[model samples]
Target: QVALRCGANDFGGTLMEENISRAAGAQYGVSLSVEEIRGIIREIGRIPKERNTLYEILE
Candidate 1:
């Protein structure tokens, strides 16, 4: 959420686990659901999108 407000146009895909983050001392098993992601984006006044394998935004 902060990242979007801070000018992040793209977000990393939904992660099922946070292995690297855990190693870096971030909260363990960090994950967000699609609904949560959309809510966060909307909270920051932006729209959420899903990309296809070719990187095209899905409708």
Candidate 2:
């Protein structure tokens, strides 16, 4: 998570439908919900911006 602390705007791959990371025993591999992501962004003192699958900002 250090990467996230270092000015990473978003947590990529959190909302993946088929999560291979979970199968590999990564507890934090679950897909993140929009609300969950928003909360995490807030906790890290940043605004949560929504984006589409193509990484386009969703207004």
Candidate 3:
């Protein structure tokens, strides 16, 4: 997760496809997409750059 923030990005979701492990519980909130993660990074005053799964620069 720290890598995501350092790369001007944010994590979207986990492969598990649920929020049960989070403090809010499974019924609270939904997962985010890549686009949403980008938006969040921007909102947090980051550049919001894209990267591949292997961490290669995309844009």
lDDT of 3 at 17: 67
In candidate 2, list every pair of residues with a backbone clash. none
Q: In model 1, which runs have C-alpha deviations exceeding 4 angstroms?
A: 13-17
- Per-residue lDDT tens digits of candidate 3, residues 1-59? 45554762334345446554465565565667868866766676667665567877786
Clashes of each: 0, 0, 0
Candidate 1 lDDT, 1-59, residue by residue in tens: 77677887655433334475677788765677779878888987888888776779989
List, residue by residue over 1-59, the lDDT tens digit for candidate 2: 35568866655555556466777788865666678767877887777788888999988
How close to the true structure is residue 50 of candidate 2, measured as C-alpha lDDT?
Answer: 80
TM-score to true structure, per model: 0.69, 0.55, 0.43
Superposition error at 41 for model 2 (Å) = 0.8
lDDT of 2: 0.70
Among the numbered candidates, top TM-score falls to 1
Give the CA lDDT, 0 to 100, for residue 10 in model 1.
57
2 in model 1: Cα distance from truth in Å? 1.4
Give the range of the ten consecutive residues with the poorest summed lDDT in model 2. Answer: 10-19
